[model samples]
Target: MHQPNKIAFFLFFILLIPFGVQAQGHEVDSLKNELKGHSTMDTIRAGLLIELANKLTYSDPNEAIPLMEEAISISKKTDWTLGEALSHRQMGNLHYVLGDNIKALDEYQKALALSHKITDRQLQSSLLSNIGNIHADLKEYDLALENYHSYLTTSQEMGNRADEIKALSNIAIIYNDTERFEKGVSYLEKALSLSKIEENDLFIAAITNNLALAYKKLDENEKALSLYLEAAELAEQMNNKYIEASALNSIGKIYLLFNDYDLAETNANKALALSKEIDAVEWQSDSWEVLSEVYEHNRKLPEALDAFKKHVQLRDSVVNEEKKSELTRKEMQFKMERQQAVAQEEIKRQQLVKNGYLIGAILLLIFSIMGYLLYKRRRDALEKRKLAEFNAKVAETELKALRSQMNPHFIFNSLNSISDFISKNDIEQADDYLVKFSKLTRSILENSEKKWITLEEDIELMKLYMQIEGLRFDNKLKYHVSMDNSLEPDNVLVPPLILQPFIENSIWHGIAPKKGGGNIDIRIAKDGTMLKYIVEDDGVGRSVQNREEKKTKDSYGIKITSSRIDIINHLKNTKGSIELMDKAEGFRVEIKLPLELQF
Candidate 1:
C-alpha cells in the first residue's frame, strides 16, 4: 500500500531543501552541527531521513521507528509541516506492517491532522487513503468508504491521476469484498482507464487483477481469465513475485472448482513454491488450502488432510495475533483510566486532610488496601485472560493438525478392475487401454508427491484417463472439453489429476448404472482475478440412495476436496472456491478462483 517511488521522491526533495536555505549565525552553525551529527539530518536531511526509514520499512521496522520519531521531532522543531506529516505517515505505515493496527490508525490520524493544517492537498489525500486502509482492515466498511471517497475527491481536486487511480482500485476492493461486484467493476474500469492514461504498467496489472476479481464474483469467468493472464504477464515483466504468486493461486482455485484436480494441484503447488521463495506467508497459506482440496478430491486423502491442517494452523495464528493485540489495547486503556481515577481520589483526600480533619492515617490505610486489592484483582484477571487466549490458540492449532490427518486412504481396487479388463478383452484394444491406464497411474504417482499442476497439462491427463474409462465402458460415454481463450495455457495451472476421480465417479456411479449413454462437459474460463470452470454430466446425478451411499463410503476424494476448497476460500486474501449443483438435466460443478496466471 505504501508506494516506494513516491516516498523516495518525497525524501529526495526534503533532503534538497536544507541546502537551499541559508542559516545566519550561531543558530545556523548549531543546526549544521546537529545535521552533521546524524547522517540523516545532512543538507536534505529530511529527505535523507525519510529515505532511510523507507528502506528499512520491511527489513528493520524497529530500527526505523526511532529514526522516524527523531525525524518527526526535527520537522516540528524546524517548522517543516510537510516533513512532519510525512514522518507521521511513515510511522503509520511501520505500525501497519508490525500488525499494530490501532497504533497505525493513531499515527495516520496524526498525519491527517497535520495535513489539514498544511497546504498540501496531495499529502492530505494520501494520509486519508491510509486511514481508509486501516478502516477496511478493521471491517468498518462504511467508514472505510467515506475515507476512500475523501481520498478520491482530494486526489481529483489536486489533479493527481496516479493517486486517483490507486484510490479507485482500493475502493473497488472494498466494494468487491462487500459483494457489490457491479460497483466494484465500475471503479476498477475507471482505474483501468486512468492507468492507461498514465501508461503505468504496475497500475495496469493491479487494475486488471481488481477487474478480474469483480468479474469472477459476477460469474464471468472468460473475461476474468483474460485479465488475470494479462496481469500476470505484466507482473512477470516487472519481476513482481507477489503478483505472480497471486495469479498462480487464482488459476489453481479455478481448476480445483471444475474438478480439474491435476491443474489445481500443479498451480497451487507452483504458487506455494513461489510464495515460500518470497517468504509470503499469506500466499503460502492460500496455496496449501488449494492443494488440500485438490488432493482430497483426487482421493489422495493423506495429502489433503496435511494441507488442511496447515491451512488451519496458519489461519489461527493470524487470528490469535489480532486478538492478542486487541486485548493488550483494552488492558492498557483500563489501566490508564484506573490510574486517572486514583489520581483524582488522591487529590480529593489531600484537600480533605488540608481542610482540618480527624479521619487521619487509619482511613488512608483502609483506602490504600482497597485500592491495592482492586488493582491486584484486575491484574490477575488480565493475566488469566492472556493465558486462556494462549491455550486456545495452541488447542486450535493442534486440532487443525489432527483434522488435516483425517483423510481416508483409497484402496487400489479400482485399478485392479481395470487390470482385470485387460486379461479378458481384445488384446490390441486392451493393450492400448493398458498403456493409457499406465499413464494415469504414472500421473497419480507423480502428483501424489506434489500439490499442484498446470491447467493445460492437467486437462491432457484427464483426457487420457477419460479415454481409458471410455474403453472400459465400451465407449458408452461422450465428453466435451472447452477453455476460454483468455486463460493463457502456459500461465494457467491447477491441482494435479483432480478431475479424473470426479469424472470416474460420473462413469462408475452416475452413467455406468444407467442403461442409456451419457455426456460430460468440462469448461474453463476466468471469473475475474478468479479462474472459473464448470463440469457437467448428463448422468443420474445425485439420486437419494447413491447420495446416502456416497456419504458413508468415507472416500477422501470429494469430501476432502470440498473441505479444502472451503479452507482456501476462507484463508486466502483473494477468492477461490468450488461448488456442486444438481440440476434437472444433470450434475453441474462450478469452480471460481482469483484470476492468477504466472509464466
Candidate 2:
C-alpha cells in the first residue's frame, strides 16, 4: 500500500517541471499550423518546432522526437544556444515520460552543458532538478540529494519562490523515501510555509499531503489524520482530484489503524471514486488496501477477499510498469556501451599513428641533448674554478681591511687606559697595566694574520685583557667564563677578537661606575648549527652610565668589532650577530656565530 502511494507521489511531479514548452493553453493542431507558417531556417522556426513537439510529448511522444531533432538543427543553424538547450531538455522529458531514464539523463546532461555555456541560471536550475529526478528514480539517493541541493541553492539565489518550493519538496520526497522521516518533515515544513506565502493552492495541497505522509511514517497518526484532512479539503477547493484522492486514501489508512471500520470504509470508498475519476491506478490500489483490512476486521470474508483481489491486481500493474522501466534502462545502457566501444577503437588507431612520429622525434632529441650536455659540462667546470679562485682572493683582502681597522681601534683604547693610570699618579699600577697590555697586544697581532682562531685561544686572550682592566680598577672587577660540556673549545673556531669589544664595554661602562664594583660572566654553548656566547655584567646598569658619561671608550671599540663581525659573516656566508640588552642591575650582550669545526 505504501509502495503504491510513493509511486503515485512521483507521478505528480512530472507536471511541475517546465521543459520543452508552455503549450497547454494552445491546441496541437494550432501549434502545428503556426510552425508550418514559418518554414525559414531561423530561431523563430526552432521555437515553434519545440512548442509543437512539447504539445505532442505526452500524446504522441514518438512523433515528437523528429520535431525536437529538427528544432535542435534549426537552433544550431541560427546560432541560438538557448533554443538548442531547451530542445535537448524537452527531448529528455519525452524520454523520461517513455521510461528510458538513461537516455533522459544523457539529454539532460547535454542541455546542462549548453546552459552553462550560455550562463542561463533558470535553465541550469531546471536541468539540475531533472537530473536529480532521474537519480531519485534509479534509487541513487546520495547523488539525488547532491543535485537537488544545487537546484535549491540556484533557485534561492534567483529568488524564484515557485522553483524554491519545488526544490524543497523534491528534496523532502527523497528523504522520506530513504526513511529519514525527521529530516523529511523539516524540509516539507519549510516548503509548506513557502507555498502558503506564494498562495499557490496546488503547491499547498501537494506539500500538505506529503507532510502528512511523513507524520504517518513517524507514528504520529493523530497529527497525520488532521493534516491529511486539511490537504483533502485544500485539494478539493482547488479541484485537484489526484491530490484529493491521495489525501483521502491516507486518511482512510489512519482510520483503519484506529479500527474505525465504518469511517475507514467510507473514506476509502470516497478515495476510490476520486482516483477512478482521475485514472490514478496507484491511489485506487492504496484505497482498496485500506478497504480490504477494514472488511476483514468486520468479519465480512467475501467482501474482504474481493477487496484483497482488487488491491493485488492494481499493485501488480504498478509493479509491471516498474519492470518495463527497468528493462528499457538496461537496453539503453547496452546500446551506449556498444557505441563507446566503437569510438574507443577509432581513438586507439589514431593514437598509434601519432606514436610512430613521436618516437622518431624523441630519439633525435635525445641524441642532440647528449651532445649539448657534454660540451656544457666542460665549459661549466672551467668557469667554476676561476670563480672560486677570485672569490677567495676577495675574501682575504676584505678580512685584512677589517683587521687593520680593529688593530688601530684596540691600540687607541689601550693607550687611553695607560694615560688614565699615569694621570692618577699610580706609578706601580701604570707599569703593571703597560706590561699586561703589551702582552695582550702581542697575542692579538699574532692571531690577526689568521682569519679564525680556536675558541680556547680566543678565551685566553680575553682573560689577559680583562686582567689588564682589573689593574686599572685596583682588582675591583670579578669575572668567570663557562663552556658547555658538549663543546670542545679547541675544536671550534671563531673570528679573532670577536668578543673583546663587548667585554671591554661591560667592564668600563657597566662595572666601573658602580659603588662596590661588579662581576662579569661569559658563557659559551652549542646552539644547533651555531655557537652561542653570552656576556653579562652586574653593575650600575646602562641607565646610570648614560647619566654619568656621554662618550665612552667601549663605544668606539664596539663599532670596530661590529664591522669586523660583518666582514666575517660575508666571507663565511653565515649569520653572525651581536645583540645587547639592559638588565635591571647591569648590561648584557649575546653573540652568535657559525659553528665551524676544525677537525
Candidate 3:
C-alpha cells in the first residue's frame, strides 16, 4: 500500500530542481574559483554562493548550509533581493532533501515573502511547490492542495508547461495519499497529456507510473500492469534507472499478488539489480520485499528469510534516519517558537510598566471583573452540582420502584406455573419445581435492592428460572445462551431483572402456546458502546399468540419493562432501544442498553 506513493515521492524529489549534483560538480567548482578570485561581498558573490549551494544541496547538504547562510547575509548587505530569495529557496531544497520539514517550510515561507515583495511570479511558484511538497510529506492535505493549486495557476499563467506538469502530478499524489484515487487519476491524466505534448520523456515516465498507481489502487490491475510496462520502457529509454527500478518493483509486487511467483521473482531480481546499480536503497528494499514474498509462496523458506532480513535492514535504515530528522526539526521549531513567545511577553511587560497609571487602573478594573466572574461561576457550579445530585436520587428511586413492580409480577407467574404442575397430578415434579423456584427467588431477592448486577449473576438467576419452568413442561422448554468472547460477564453490568420480563413473556406467551413446545436462543453481545440482548423463540409467533389469547397478562410485564428502559435512557442520556419482530415460526425481541462496566 505504501510502495506506490513512496515511488512517486522519490520522483517528485528528483524533479524538484533541474540540475543534477554529479553532472554539475565541475560547474560548482568553477563558481567557487570565481568567488575566491573576486573576493568581494557583492551581488555577484552572493549569486555565485547560491548557485554553488544549489549544486551541493543533495550531495553534501551540510556544506551547502554555510554557503546558503553566507549568501543570504551578503545578498542583504548588497540589497540584492533576487539573490536573497534564491538563497532561501535553495536552503529550503537542501532542508527538504535532509528530511528537515520544519526548517524547509520556514525557508520556503521566507523565500515566498521575498518573492511577493519583488513580484517574481517564477520564484513564487517555485516556493509554493516547495511548500506544497513539505505539507504533503507532513500529511497536511488541505494546505498541500492549496499550495499546489497556486503553483499550478502561476505556472499556467507563465506558459511554463514543465512546471505545470509537475504541479498537476504533485496534486495527484496528494489525492492518492488521501485515498481519492479517482481524483488522482483525473490530475495525472492532465499531467500525462501535457508531458506528451512537450515530448518530455522524464515527465511522461513519472506521470505514467503515477497514473498506474492510481489505477492499481482502484483495482484496475490490467490497466495498471500495461501502464507500468510503458513507464518501465520509457524509463529504460531515458536511462533513468531509478524510475525503471521502481516500476519493475511495483510490477513484481502485483505479480506476487496474482500468485505468479516465477514472474514475481524475475521482476524483483531485475529491479534489485537496477536499484543496486543506481544506489537506490529504498527501491532495493522494495524489491527485496517482493522477492521475500515470492520465495515464501514457493516454499523456499531459507531464501525467503534471507530476503526478508535484507528488506528489513534496508527499510529500517531509511525509516530511522527520516524519524530522527523529523524529531530534530520539531524540537528546533518548538524552541524557536518558545523563544519568540517569551520575547513578546517581555515586550508587553515593558509596555505596561511604561504606562504605569493606565496599567494600574486597568489592572484594578480587571481584578474587579474577575472577582465578579468568579462569584458567578461559583454560584453556577453549586446549582449544577445540586441539580445533578437531585437527578441521581430521583433515578435511583425510580429504578427501585420499577424493580419492586417487576419482582412480584415475576413471582406470580412462577407460582402460577407451579400451581398448574400440581393441578395436573404431578406431585413429585411440583416438589422439584418448588425447590428450584425457592432457590431462584432467593437469588432474585439478593439482587433486588441493587440498581445493577453483573451479567454473570443475572444469567445465573435466568438459568434457574428457566430450569423451574422447564420442569413444568417436562423439559420441553429448551434454551441456549451465548455471549461474545470480547465481553467479560463479571465486568459487565445490567439493570437487575432488566431482561427477566422479556424472557418470561417469551416462555409463557411464545413457547407454551406451541404444539410440541420450542427452543429459545438468548444472545448477548457488544454493539459499539451499547450492550445488545436478543431473545428469540422458535414457537408460536406473536400473531398466533394474540389470536389464541387476546388479553394476555404477559403484556403487562412487557409494558413495565418498556417503562423501566425509558427511565434508563433518560438517566444515561443515551439512545437505549427495544425492537420486537414476529417471525413466521416464532417471535424475536432485541433490546439495546447502554453498556456499563465495573472497571
Candidate 4:
C-alpha cells in the first residue's frame, strides 16, 4: 500500500493567480479595447482565460466554469481550433474532478476533435491520456487500455519521457486493478525507472508507492513495508501531505495484516490526523475505515461501529461535495448563457428601425445578434451540463452503495458461524477457531478497503477458509491446491474468497451426502494476460434423471459467484467468466480472468 503524493489545490490556485494577473494587466485590457473598436483580439486572451480557469478548478470551479464558457465563446467567434481544443480539455478536467463523467467524456471528445483538426501531436496525446483516465475511472478497462496505449505510443514518438511515464503508470494501475499483477508490476517498474532517470521525485515517489502496493498484494510484507517507508520519506521530503497520509495508511494496513493491532491503530490514527490537516476528505474516509477494522479486530465493538459510521459519513460527504461542485459549474454556465441571450435580444430589437436609423440599428443589431447567439448557446450548454451533473451524481451514489454492501454480508455470515461455535462446549476448539475466524475477518475487513490484492495473499486466505471448513466437515471431504513455482509469487492477485465459495459448494452440496467421501482439486496456470483457475470435484455429479434438482441446488452458489464475477467484469470492463461443467465423474468449475499481478 504505497501512497502517492497529491498536489494541493492551493498550489494550482497560486499558479493561476499570476496568469490571471497577466491576463488582467495586458491580455484582458487589450481584448476589451479591441472589443470596443469592434475588432477581434483573436483567441489569445481566450486561451489564457482557459488556462487560468484550469488553475482555479479545485479551488473555485464555480468561477472557472464561467471563464471556460467565455473562452469557448471567444474561440468559436475566432474559429481558433487550438484555443477551442485547450478550452474543452480544461472543461473536461473540471467535470471529471466534479464527478460529472458523462460531461467529462463529452468535453474530452470535443477536445480530441479539435486537437485532431489542428494536428497538435502533444495536445492530442495529452487529450487521449485524459480520455483513457476517464474510462479507467468508469471501469471501462479495454477502452482505457486502448487509449493508454495510443498515448504511450504518441508520447514515445515525441520523446516526451514525462508523458510516457504517466501513460505507463496509468496502464500499470489498470493491470493492478484487474488482478494482472505481473504485467502491472512490469509497467510500474518501467515508469519508476524512467522517473528516476528524469530525476522527478514526485513521480518517483508515486511509482514507489504503487510498487509497494504490488508487493503487498504478493504477500511480500517486508518489501512492501520498505517501499512504503521510502515513499513516505520522499513524500515528507516533498511536503506532500496527501501522499504522506496515504503512506501512513499503507503502513497501517500492513500492520493490520501482520496482526499488530496497536501499530495498525496508531498508523491509521496518524493518517486520519494528516488527512484532516490537509482537508483530504477521501483519504480521511479511508483512514476511518481502516480504524474501524482495527477496532473491530480488537473486540472494541462500540468503537468499531462508531468508526464505521464515521467512515460512511465522510464518504457520503465527499460524494456530496463532488455533486455540489458539478451543480455549481452548471449554474455558472447557465448564468453566463443567460447574460449573452439578454444582450442578443436587445440587439435584435434594434434591427427593425428604419431609414437614417438603419445604420445605427444595423450596428446595434450585429452586436445584439452575436450576444444573443452566445447567450442561447450558453443556456443550452448549461442545460446539458445540469442533466449530466445529475446523472453523474446518481451513478456515483449507486456505485458507492454497491461497494458498501458487498463485504457486510460476508461479515454477518462469518460472525454467525463464530457464534454457533461458541454455543458448542468445545472450548479449545472454539478458541482456535475464533483465532482463525478473527484473522479471516480482519483480512476481509482490511483488504476490502483496497481495490486490489496480491495473488499470494488471496491464495493464503483461500487455504485458511478451506482449513476451517475441513475441520467442520472432517473426513467428509479432502482437497488439494497445487501451484507452479514458475508462477511468481509477486505477480498474481485474485478476488478474495473467490475460490472458497465454489469449494464450499462442492463440499456441502456435491460431496457431503456421499458415503465414501470426495476430493476437490484446485490448480492455477498462466494463460497469456490471464491467470486460469480450475476447480474440479469428484463427487455426485449432476444426475441425468434429476437434472432440474441438481441444477437448482448448484445454481445457488453458482449464481452468487457469477453475480460477483459480473460485478467485477463491470467494474473492470473486462471479459472474465465462470463456467460449471459436468464431467464424466463429477462437477468442474473453470474460471478465467485477467492476470493482474505485480511481480
Overall lDDT per candidate, in order of appearance? 0.68, 0.77, 0.77, 0.72
Q: lDDT by residue for model 4 over 1-599, one digit each (tens)? A: 00010121211222223435555556545644544564344676785676567556665667678878888988998898888888888887777767666677688889889888889999988888777866675566898899989999999999999888888888888898898988989998999899999998888877888889888888899999999999989988987776778888999889888899898898899889989997888888889988989877786654665686677568767755665554554444444455566676566545534432656647866667657766876786577666655544444433342343334454445445545555674545655665676677567656643556787888887777766666566556788888777687566767666666677667766787677888899998887777788999888877788668877766655665566566667667778889878878778989987777665
Lowest lDDT sum, 10 consecutive residues, model 2, at: 1-10
> Runs in model 2 with CA error above 4 Å?
1-26, 326-353, 361-599
- Tell me the TM-score of each prediction against the true structure: 0.50, 0.56, 0.58, 0.51
List model 2 lDDT by residue over 195-299, tens digit each.
Answer: 889888888888888899999999999999999999999888977787888888989889878978899899899999998997999889999989988976785
lDDT of 1: 0.68
Instruction: Mark the 10 consecutive residues where model 4 has the least summed lDDT.
Output: 1-10
Model 1 lDDT per residue over 1-599, tens place: 25222211211122222322343234444644655776654326875566667656665678779878888877877888878889889988888778776677778888878888886787888788777877676566798889889989988988888778877887888898899999989998998898898898777776787687678789887787778788778878977676778878887776766778887788888888888998877778889989877875675644654676576556546645655554555444444445556676677557655543455557767567567766776686577666555444433333332232221122133244444554465445644654575466556555543445678777887787678667767889989999898777677766555455467667766678777779889998877677777888988877766677864552545665554455445445666666778777567777775554556
The per-candidate count of clashes, in order, stands at 41, 0, 0, 13
Question: Candidate 4: how many backbone clashes?
Answer: 13
Q: Worst ten-residue run, lDDT, model 1?
A: 5-14
Segments of candidate 4 deviating more than 4 angstroms: 1-41, 285-599
